[model samples]
Target: MADEIKNTENQELDWDSPISKDAGEFEIPPIGEYTFTVANLEKTMSKSGNKMADLTISLDVNGQAYVRHDYLVLTSNMAWKLASFFECIGLKEKGQELTHMPWDKVPGARGRCKIIHEDYNGRPTVRIDRYLPLTGSAPAQATAATAPANDMPFEV
Candidate 1:
């Protein structure tokens, strides 16, 4: 089922809300003017609920910020819409080497769209960081060589 999304990169959005108007034709941003991209999307549905997904989107655009953590968490369908938008922005799928981020999730009936805000400088900037993942290096190797294996009995 997910393959449908993983296949082709080109796709259209139903865009059922008014909020998308400002985003639809967003300029690609001048070469060095600014760099924006949806970084990661995460969704979790209550095991007992009627398929309601709680979502948190992280972004890595411009400097760094998360406009909204609870941006909108409704249903799987809506979640994909937000995910697709990010994909189109080149942030979700920039490349495999530099960074790897998850997808954002949204609810079915996300109310009228509006710009999410985050405190950046003295101004209220959008929280694009919500779509990004925390970046850090792997742990270092132990100072000693290969240590002795555990004696506990536990077959593979």
Candidate 2:
């Protein structure tokens, strides 16, 4: 069906045309920090039934573009991760508190994140290790380079 395939040109494909198999496998980027922009966000439920925000982020590594998905599961266990993400996206300052999350403001927001390679289901994959403060917009209390290792990125 025309709607089934995600063709870049948006044209209907010829059913009998030979398909190209030259598409190569994805190459995982090196582990490190990279600048990322929020491509999309969907509020959903995680596998364990916790409320979550699924974030699609576009990463730029030395001029090459990569994409990765990260989830913010709203649970006490994942609070630190959520805080870091909010801080990285400029939603809140380090140690600041918030009564509500403005989810609409997340799309198009830019930030920094650390990426890592790991095995998931026996297949190699890349994942966002953690979020970092955006460059040039460090929190008033501490710069990115000086922020403590355990610093929380959201309001308590």
Best lDDT among the predictions, by candidate number:
2
The reply for model 1, stretches above 4 Å from the true place, is 1-40, 46-55, 59-62, 70-156
lDDT (0 to 1) per candidate: 0.33, 0.76
Error of 2 at 77 (Å): 1.8
lDDT of 1 by residue, 40-149 (tens): 33455656554343333232234343223433345555655445434433334423331423333222111212234444555444432223221243112123255458
> How many backbone collisions does model 2 have?
2
- TM-score, one value per model: 0.24, 0.74
Model 2 agreement with the true structure over 1-156: per-residue lDDT tens digits = 111111132446788988776965566778998888787899999999999999888787777667778889999899889888988988877888966888888887888899988887676778799999766664232122667757879856
Compute the lDDT of residue 93 as modeled in candidate 2.
Answer: 79
lDDT of 2: 0.76
